[model samples]
Target: MSILLILALVVAMGAVLYALVRGVIAMANGKDVSGEVQQGYMQKRVLYQGIAIVIVVLLLVVAKSNGS
Candidate 1:
């Protein structure tokens, strides 16, 4: 179970990184002058960040329970 959670955390972190880089690239490219494309990526990044945070909290909880 802990291993599964760790794997999920890694995937979530990777998603967050991917979103951030994509968003940065889109913004830097200036292809979407209206900023719509960048906004979508930003939203995805935030969502992934939230997921990562939740996973981290779960990991902490699991660790605490195991240690106790």
Candidate 2:
């Protein structure tokens, strides 16, 4: 179960990284057409970061509880 949560956290982190890179690329292109795509990637990046944070908190809580 802990391993599963760790895997999910990693996936979430990867998603955030992917979105960040894509958004940067879109911005670098400097085209109006890519604006919407960049926005979408930014939103996804935020969502994935949130997921990662939650996972980290859950892992901490679980570890703490188990340790006691």
Candidate 3:
């Protein structure tokens, strides 16, 4: 269970990082339509970060239950 939690956290963080970098690159491109692309990436980054947070909370709950 701990291993699974670690892997899930890693994957979620990686997704967030990927979206962030893509958004930055799109913004830097300075094209007229880049705003829409950046917005999409920003949304995806938020979603991934949210998922990571939820997973972390779940892991903590599981650990606490097991300890008791």
What does candidate 3's lDDT look like per residue over 12-46, in tens digits? 99999999999999999989473899999999999
> Which has the better lDDT: candidate 2, or candidate 3?
3
Error of 3 at 17 (Å): 0.5
Q: After superposition, how far is residue 18 of candidate 1 from its true place, in Å?
A: 0.5
- Model 2: lDDT of residue 51: 94
lDDT of 2 at 64: 91
Cα lDDT of model 2 by residue, 1-68, tens digit: 78999999999999999999999999888885648989998999999999999999999998999999
lDDT of 3: 0.94
TM-score of 1: 0.96
TM-score per candidate: 0.96, 0.91, 0.93
Q: Assess candidate 2 and give its lDDT.
A: 0.93
Per lDDT, the best of the predicted structures is 1
CA shift at 28, candidate 3, in angstroms?
Answer: 0.5
Root-mean-square deviation of every model: 0.6, 1.3, 1.1
Local accuracy of candidate 1 as per-residue lDDT tens digits, 13-49:
9999999999999999988999999999999999999
